[model samples]
Target: MTANPLAPSWLAPPADANDLAASVWPANARRSAADELVFAGVPASVLTERFGTPLYVVDEADARARARGFREAFERECARIGTGVTVYYAAKAFLSSAVAEWMTGEGLSVDVCSAGEFAVALAAGVAPARMGFHGNNKSLVEIDTAVEHGIGAIVVDSPIEVERIASAAERHGRVQAVRLRVNSGVHAHTHDFLATAHEDQKFGISLTEAPGVVASIRSHSSLRFLGLHGHIGSQIFGADGFEESAARLLGLHHELLAGGAIPELNLGGGFGIAYTAADDPTPVDVLARQIADIVASECARLGIAVPRLAFEPGRVIIGPSTVTLYAVGTVKRVTVALPAAFETAPDDSTDPSAHAAAGHPEPATAVRTYVSVDGGMSDNARPALYGADYTVRMANRVSAAQPALVRVAGKHCESGDIVVHADYLPGDVEPGDTLAVAATGAYCWSLSSNYNYLGRPPIVAVKGGAARLIMRGESIDDLLARDPGIGSATRKASTAPAHAEPAPAQAAAQRAS
Candidate 1:
């Protein structure tokens, strides 16, 4: 069958529906001896039986390898050019105590953007001095938390936030290291919402305002101005944006240094990763070389010494190392009428079925299949939030059936709850089969929710043919614990206890289960 005209331009039917794309999948993922998809030598069948459906499996070896690659590549490039560099794992992509520990063992720092993220880093035994706190808006309590813990640097997003951090630092009797985030007005080629340094976003201070903000930070004795930082956007593919951002930042760095010395400069991370065949991401070594060359060239042109450099990569490192496995629940076929003349849907009706039922005239009808899975946007909100595209493959077994264009949907009531908008699956795809969605390791779990009262799925890490749960699944009781209205039963106790109640040991155990 030919590619569907209604599908997005970037999507094309593969020669073989069963053939997995190597670019988007984890490094260790491949067809096993049993002809099934395996991650780190463990088959998807084994994972499904042991952990059940709607499971997230991380190839631990792949993740560590990527981390090592980034660190080594950056270090090598910086050393070749005689510049120092640090690689900070962006915690916003996905953070767990174990993951943080892995980063620590790999000799990488962390970039945290919230108090909770900082707490997670602390819980994982990561030194506070190795972490950089970032966010556009930092509440006084959060600023105090960072100051009290002696965080390495707090990336100030606004002039007002600079004052807030300074006040908190003074209150704690500590000198806070700070970096001012500047919008370079460079637009990266990506989704509009992910583009940060485009001058209009809520992320960083505009280039025009950054100089004044730096002076404000320098005015506060409690705040130590580290350097200037610029992040163009996330999921960036080309080095053009990085180079442009570096040049602009270096220009500002030259101006800022006339009075005082700047020790460090941060070119923020928005490195892109392959999510589907449409995406072709730059290799870590190549990206490092490109960035190093650009920074080195800028510094040479400006006749200034290279400052200590750092980058926070969250998606590129984590995105390809994980896959989400969900079980097919239902498959329904529907007839869609092709639009006449302009290929536009009627403004009066948004529902295809409703429009058809109304007996509207049409040129032709196209039959499409909807494969519904047990999980939806609650576990991975990227699809609903940003229309993020993902690739899907049947993981349990191999088949020779012809390709069938299908839309993989979630169990949620919302019509926008789609996982894979368009993908070619085997015609024999059916219920009880395991479907693996590749390149979901980045933001899916980090942005998951408990919507519709459904428990968040557990994350399983696979290494050396071994599988272990890194994070346990949430239970109904776990959700109930936060509800104050419900005590021992559905309702609160009628009488108050004279003594403090024993820690809900049984409830805790149930949640663990």
Candidate 2:
């Protein structure tokens, strides 16, 4: 059911694995004649040399392509199924003024789960009416801010939030359109997405009580019920999950109408994206078809008019469109007894980071790669959080050297702060070589931190021969500013230890999983 480490992944050898896989890389990503990987034609060497190690590079084209895919999916599905669709790019995946413009420009609306995210959208000139606010435990201030800004609609989770939104909207002399986030109790099969539905995690109202919730919304003259929204989970691979969640939601919609509540229904989005070679995510067009099919069929079965369909996708669109470029800071080799249990494959094993519902195949890893970089969990937490392995390659130069066994780690002061669990990098791997990791533009930067007082990297959008900074690199002064009180009391951690790097552990935990 899962790939064996001994067998390499299909995209093995990695000769051009460093070359931007246009499908997974930014639109402008390419390699220069000098063998330097160019994002938007801007060389990786230039980025690291100018900005230093652990720099964040984005392809403007990649970001835009994802936004456009969502827009196009909605449009095409609307034309086919006749049910209106609104694609809301979830800001939590990765939000920035520059990215906000890209999403809105593609005709996609923004989904802000918090006041801070809303502020970013509104500040970026995203129209208030194009925003859908959602949060389970929204702060009173967040609701107040959303209402004050007149966001398109606030997806209400709990009754407390409803009362707050009502009061806030009333204060503004406006009835905020509200959507009830209903949990359908579907055990959405996913890694990061499963907990959202465990009833233990803070999220939507349960499906059984959604009618009463809808009734309450209808009773509030100050509240306008836009519809019912259901997000089962995230990183979903196909439409079966969507169809099931929609079916449950449509039944609730029918009951609401019978009780004299005609609210719009939103089958929320949690589409998956490929983070590795193994993932085979459905195309936006295919996803659109499935969504439209469910909505149309459900509307007919329930004898209810089709309401506007809405989706919130953060990863699906952004995941493949970006990759993280890192420079190999060190390489070490060690030997340890292979776990006897894993020496032979587990009969029904799984990779937690693999896109849900995708096919499984073996990987070629006769020799695995253990490559360490200057960054770790402090930069990209996915690998350490979900055992998310990545495909890496030499970007700064073409290497004829054989791929070596390696484990990538970060400089975070934690032993568990690993990056790629196992990957193949050229045996010639050295401190100066550039290592390109695909599908990183989504979660990597958004979740990065400044552990060990290490400065965060600058974010640059690469397009052939042109790179612009969206977020600037953190300077030593920026780090010092946080601790003016400690500047005199603190000294950089012992440099001798920094120089005498520890040998890479042979059997490090798969922290990403």
Candidate 3:
């Protein structure tokens, strides 16, 4: 089979389009004897039939295992240096009450960045001391809330946040533990938008300013300094950036020891994961050992004791444990110009002789199929936001047809509302086919929106052949319930004629079902 000239260089024609890459899917994902895709023993067809299309299916066992794996890996490595490690599940990746419970049950702390996340964790019964609050622009109310709840540690992003946290702690008549976030100037090999520790980013204060901020934090009677926090970026592949950042942070940590005791150091987590067959992310255990050695050696070089460690891993734990399932709504094949590097001999169908007879020029072209799904940017915006690439496969059943290059699109109004940028699916893919996008468990739901009035999908956790809704999908009514005009009109029209029909959104939703 010839490779598609239009496909990305990193994408290769698979030996079998139906085969699932183990690294890019949940641990329990497999093709059953019936050729149906199953996650955690629940078939994809069963999940879509029960939960509807455009659903987020998470493998409960896979997620829980990752959480436990991270905790164990870090603990084991840090134990070599006579120190302990705290693994904080970064809630910004994907958080629900069930996920919060799962993480905590695995003995991992929760790291939340906003008031809503903090509230969700609290409601899920996550201990206040096991939750760390983080945000660059945390409002006074947020600080007050964190202090009121006696949160574990508030990561202060700027110098002013130190005072804000201190004021809030003073008001609560308690001393709050705080970590000063600093940019170690390590340029991680990642997208510019994902890199946070670069000097010009919005996330943290400069390494030069961190010392003064730490002094100010210690000056406050209501604040206890918990050392420094540094995050390089998201979706990072190797530990080179982490090692460099650790070396820089340790330099600061050594200097800070002159002032007072700094017990714990947090190297924020941006560990990467395999999103496609082309990705080879460092395993968690290997990453733990590599980073542990880097920090230990750096501390030894600086003649400073290794501080207790903390990490905030979000995507690495949750990203590969779930998949987004969508129903194909349309399929269109369009002729596109092939790259010059991929130019080939003119076939009879596209030959200059046939073109001349038809009054057209011979073109170096290839057919690219665009498979439109029931959902798009409204459900997963990573493609539009970061130009993120994802892999897709026919989930309802396996196919024996030849592989065809495909662009999985969404039903949104925008042209950029792509789901999978480029991948190969069975040539027979058509409307009503269930397509599953692998490794969508991280930011898809967390960054979802209501663009084009599309209702957000639900997240279902499947385990032991049992599926349970961890988060309910939003309906049209849920979207309209917040509109003042719609609510008022609905209430006023309640006394109208009995033959009146349902709202347009409701009717469309009913027809969709």
The most accurate candidate by TM-score is 3
RMSD for each of the candidates = 7.4, 8.3, 4.6
Ranked by lDDT, the better of candidates 1 and 3 is 3
lDDT of 3 by residue, 1-513 (tens): 667777888999888999999989999999999998999899987887777778899999999999999999999999987789999999999999999999999999999999999999999999999999999899999999989999999999988888889899999999999998989987664423333444887988998888889989989999999989998888988788888889889999999899999999999988899889999888899999999999999988998889999999999999999999887777899888655455455542123332344655555677789998888898899999999999899998888888889999988889999999899988888777788999999999999998877778889999999999999887766666678778545643222112122333443454365
Identify the candidate with maximal lDDT.
3
Candidate 3 residues lying further than 4 Å off, grouped into runs, are 190-198, 339-342, 345-361, 488-513
| TM-score against truth, every candidate | 0.89, 0.85, 0.92
Expressed as tens digits, the lDDT of each residue in 1-513 for candidate 2 is: 233344345534344334444455556667778876777667877776665556677777777877887778777877676667788998888888988999999889999887788888988999999999887788888888888878899998986677788889889898889999887866454332232332654787887777777777777778898888888776777777777778888887887777665546777777777655666777888878778888888888877788877888888767666666665656665433333344443322223323234566333123344567766787788877776767566777876665555677776778778877665555667765667777777678878877786666677777657777787766656666577586744655432211122223311222111
Give all candidates' CA lDDT scores: 0.83, 0.71, 0.86
lDDT of 1 by residue, 245-338 (tens): 7888899899989869899889989889988988887787998999999999999999999898989988887889999998777788776666
Model 3 / residue 227 / CA error / Å: 0.5
Query: How many collisions between residues are there in candidate 2?
Result: 31
Model 1 lDDT at residue 33: 71
Model 2 lDDT at residue 500: 24
Residue 223 C-alpha lDDT in model 2 = 87
